[model samples]
Target: MLPSITPFGGMNLRPRSSGSGGVEEARNALGQRLRELRRRAQLSGKQLAESLSWQPSKVSKIENGKQTPTDDDIEAWTRATDTEHETEALLASLHTLEVQHAEWQRVLKAGMLGHQLELSEQDAKTRLYRSFEPAVVPGLLQTAEFARALFSRAIMVHRVPNDVNDAVAKRMQRQEMLYRTDKAFHFVITEAALRYRLCAVDTMLGQLDRLVSLTSLRNMRLGVIGYETQYVVDPRHGFMIYNSDLVRVETYSAELNLRQSHEIGLYTSTFEKLAAVASYDAAARAVINRAIADLASAQPEDGE
Candidate 1:
């Protein structure tokens, strides 16, 4: 999904905020701590850089949060500042920051096509996919038109490079895994997903038709949580659980790749709770059909 820092004894394990600002803020906090250590040793920036054999700009960048320090960099900084005891804690914060938050601008730097390919690689390694979506269809189940619409919006909103056609093609390519007998897919989506007007009416209709056809697949199980179903747990956000180990959660500005055992367990339990209240097979198709009917009714007749 996406890719934090803390203090010596009081490490800020959680992000300060939900946006990319939180990550940037955490990095700045780390830099401030390192700068404090340097000052406590009575070393000027250039002197510290010289002692560490790093360029003066390197010290400035790290101290300004413009550059993230490597493990070795952290070690050298701690040594030069006579704050070696802080090394372990600093390293822990650095690793946590690297592993937890991945901003969209950086993740999509090469373009959306690259991100799609990376997701494809992830899917290839996963045998059981359990996804819950409260807003839109999961990437694996999205139609080309729907995917195109989504990618176009992302490009505009995130100001990422425009590679919509390539990205859409790659997403369609990823769908080939659906037919693999070795893998199984179980997706639970709220009825709101089907009714969300993210794309044109015709495209939405076609997308719902695709969902209907997919329901009969031997390796795929689709579930629709209708409005009438009472949720056992609050569907706070959408997430995908790959097997039993990892959970991929997407936010407005970043993607969260949660790997902790407790985090995975919580999501797994949440998915089970959502899936239990959902309708499957014919019932799931009925939900899709209803959405299609609603859209069709809204369309003007041939004469008007």
Candidate 2:
């Protein structure tokens, strides 16, 4: 997936599950656990806050899942409530929640190849892939040269260890899933994505051509939203939905994995709205071909 065009925004470290309630449910559960510890210790919220030198509202926020507790906060809370034994378990839960909203640097700690493998594992489990992009081509549909360009930029920007070759190979390997008869893919991209000069003009032209060819796959659906189309919902950022179960949102700093049913439904609806205004089939090809022609025409003549 391509990074969002916007600057890094704060992330919600709340826990999420496969259940209907998703993040809120998991958050509330963690909060409830803390609340139970306090209650068992015979301490009121006000008393606990005062004991820990915290504002009374901090207790409420932590207990209500509005605020995530830091390790120090959890340790202090457990000690104040005479439930120190539960400290480790609570910290474990907190770490689990934190993993769901992983910073890109940490995710790429082992290098880009590791991250690509992680994506491949996720892809292996998904039977239906619905992707929407406003900034660049979706990773699964990206050609090798285009993928290399994107990966190179990511390496330079994030200052991660260089593994472009291995990472690109893994990404290309993942694309093999596209040929599987059991899976289906739906990709919606904006005309602006086609025009973005993220790579050499020649490489982008090849990528656009790749998109044109991908449209003919029996199980794949490609949608292109031209600039002339009026917006229904704001195309905030690109996201991928995997089989109605998971929504992967990439940001400039991190990746958000949303598993809540409601969140998935929201993205699903948004994708449908974007797809509705897209040009598909022959129209989609025409849009892609136009981009190709534009790039070709703009190319400098030999010796110019």
Candidate 3:
């Protein structure tokens, strides 16, 4: 007999699991909308789950967006809550998300990860990229040499050997979105980043030069908070804010995304506090240039 297998080849085939930020965002948006409707209907999770013959845990999963609801679940929910028309409309709007998290083979076969990512990210009207590093420049502003060194370190030491060239190229390509008339990119970087030298002396100098050059763009802004300055916003984690609609926090094992109003408010406030303490314009540039010079000077004689 043929081995038992799922129609999708036993793969989860969930759209949010595709490792694409765009797909993830769409999934999250659907979840947020579902929770809002549930709240508006005044249906406690238990009540909703019981009415649909589902476990409370399952209801929680659907609302939290940990799991996607099938068509039957959606119909059951809408009918039970007396919001069939509104729910139907919401489902139509989110149909794209239903297929967003496709399998990796599908993406690879299409050979368009970069383009697809660009399309997804571009859908956002605005973006704010925040970075904190014990060492090394942020990828968005990194020079080729600096990027190579950093990738080597991450791959060799951290064992996260992403395709360095492909990843770097994707990052640089993403920067173009800042210049587009439709949207702009905002950057927040830690001063400690300026002090770190990930590559050779010359490469570090080149990277700093690039950073200085990019600072003049009208669509982009960079801020640096001196390490000696007391920080009012003490974030225990490092996160990136996307389009003011999503917060992505990073950890060694996985990433956490926050879209709930309460969490979003917390990060917004945290970012503002960090920005308040940061130095911008000439002051920030001066700090970066000085660090570059200091790193260059610390190198030994050519023959040594």
Best by lDDT: 2
Residue range 17-111, candidate 3, lDDT tens digits = 21345545666777777777788899998988888888899988877767767677777788888888877677774555544443333223333
Off by over 4 Å in 3: 1-136, 157-162
Candidates in order, TM-scores: namely 0.76, 0.79, 0.58
Query: CA shift at 69, candidate 2, in angstroms?
Result: 6.2
- Model 1, 61: alpha-carbon shift in Å? 15
Residue pairs whose backbone atoms clash in candidate 2: none
| TM-score of decoy 1 | 0.76
The better candidate by lDDT, 1 or 2, is 2
The global Cα lDDT (0 to 1) of model 1 is 0.80
For 102-159, candidate 2 gives per-residue lDDT tens digits of: 6687788777898888887888799999998887888888899988888887778788
Q: Whole-model Cα lDDT per candidate?
A: 0.80, 0.81, 0.60
Off by over 4 Å in 2: 1-82
What does candidate 1 score in Cα RMSD to the true structure? 7.9
Q: Per model, how many backbone clashes are there?
A: 4, 0, 1
Per-residue error for 280 in candidate 2, Å, reads 1.1
After superposition of all CA atoms, the RMSD between model 2 and the true structure is: 5.1
